[model samples]
Target: MHSNVVGGSDRIGEIIEVRGADGTPPYRVRYPDGHESLMFPGPDCVIEQGSATAAAGRR
Candidate 1:
């Protein structure tokens, strides 16, 4: 997760399906084993995937 509130937080993940009314809702990400899990967001939440792990040093 990175900063989102102009000082808030932002996260990255492989999107599965965006569910909700305004398109802001929970997401599904694939695990290392190829299994997926739901990433539920709170009210007025948004998600974005950015730079690769290699570039972010997450690799």
Candidate 2:
């Protein structure tokens, strides 16, 4: 996700849980850092779904 702060790093993660439907906020994400957070994606954030091929590559 992109950050509103200048030079804030984007994060790549798996969506572990979704608190709402219909593209809602407060999503739980497990990041590559092995930490998780309940995120409310802001205007600067861009969420991308991981492809099956990409998931396989991680293993």
Candidate 3:
């Protein structure tokens, strides 16, 4: 997820659990720093599909 703060970098996290019906919003995510939170994504968030490797920028 993109940081709301200016000059802040984006965050990377794994979707450990899904709270939304039919895989919608409100995901349970675990970050690399070992923190987890329930997230309802905003417009800055983007969901990418493909290989396990990560990449940035919009589609």
Candidate 4:
């Protein structure tokens, strides 16, 4: 499985650094603009598993 970043969604940030927040995956996302936020992995974000994002990377 892999992570997917959707467009029109809240832009976490560029070079987004993810961590576990409250034990949640993608706990936090840091943007290049010198801003960071806590991500809720599923509710606020989702994992994308398909050919579209086959890089097997993160958001």
lDDT of 4 by residue, 1-59 (tens): 12355444454343244466554465455565767776555555445334536434544
Q: Each prediction's Cα lDDT score? A: 0.59, 0.80, 0.78, 0.48
lDDT of 4: 0.48
Query: After superposition on all CA atoms, how large is the RMSD of candidate 4?
Result: 8.3
**Model 2: residues with Cα > 4 Å off, grouped in runs:** 52-59
TM-score of 1: 0.40
The candidate that achieves the highest TM-score relative to the unseen native structure:
3
Off by over 4 Å in 1: 1-12, 42-46, 49-59
What does the lDDT read for residue 29 in candidate 2? 84
Could you tell me every candidate's TM-score relative to the true structure?
Answer: 0.40, 0.64, 0.73, 0.32
State the lDDT of candidate 2 residue by residue for 1-59, as single tens digits: 76667888766778777898886878998888889999888776777788989867875
Clashes by residue pair, model 4:
21-27
Candidate 3 — which pairs collide? none
Q: Backbone clashes per model, in order? A: 3, 0, 0, 1
Better of 2 and 3 by lDDT: 2
Model with the higher TM-score, candidate 1 or 3? 3
